[model samples]
Target: MSTISETYTVTGMTCGHCVASVTEEVGAIDGVTNVAVDLPTGAVTVTSTKPVSVDAVRAAVDEAGYSLV
Candidate 1:
């Protein structure tokens, strides 16, 4: 299988804890292999084995106590 990557915008992340939270939750999603968050730009890049669900991503962000914008 090939890797699928996506970038999403997130809001309300203020520090490293927030970054770790988002990374942990999103990285837990099935098939997710890598999660890179750019705090300065509020950009989250997710690399997975397959196309991930928007709803799942939204939920993961929510679990991290943040909003995906």
Candidate 2:
């Protein structure tokens, strides 16, 4: 399967725990295979086996108490 990566600017992630929360939330999506969050940069990278919808990612971020910028 081809892997897809997406970079999203996430807000309200001020600490490592916030990053972890975002990571767990996004990583729970069906297509998502991996996730990385850079707290300082407010960037969240998601790797997936299939095309991951931006709306789904945004929803996950929102569920995690963060916003996609």
TM-score to native of every candidate shown: 0.97, 0.95
For candidate 1, write residues 1-69 as lDDT tens digits: 789999999999999999999999999999999999999998999999988999999999999999999
Best by lDDT: 1
Name the regions of candidate 1 deviating beyond 4 angstroms. Answer: none
Q: How many residue pairs clash in all the candidates, one count each?
A: 0, 0
RMSD for all candidates, in order, please.
0.6, 0.7
Overall lDDT per candidate, in order of appearance: 0.97, 0.93
RMSD of 2: 0.7
| C-alpha lDDT of residue 35 in model 1 | 96
Worst 10 residues of 1 by lDDT: 49-58
Could you give me the TM-score of model 1 versus the true structure?
A: 0.97
Q: How displaced is residue 7 in candidate 1, in Å? A: 0.1
**In lDDT terms, how accurate is model 2?**
0.93
Q: Pick the candidate with the highest TM-score.
A: 1
- Residue 17 lDDT, candidate 1, scale 0-100: 95
Clashes of 2: 0
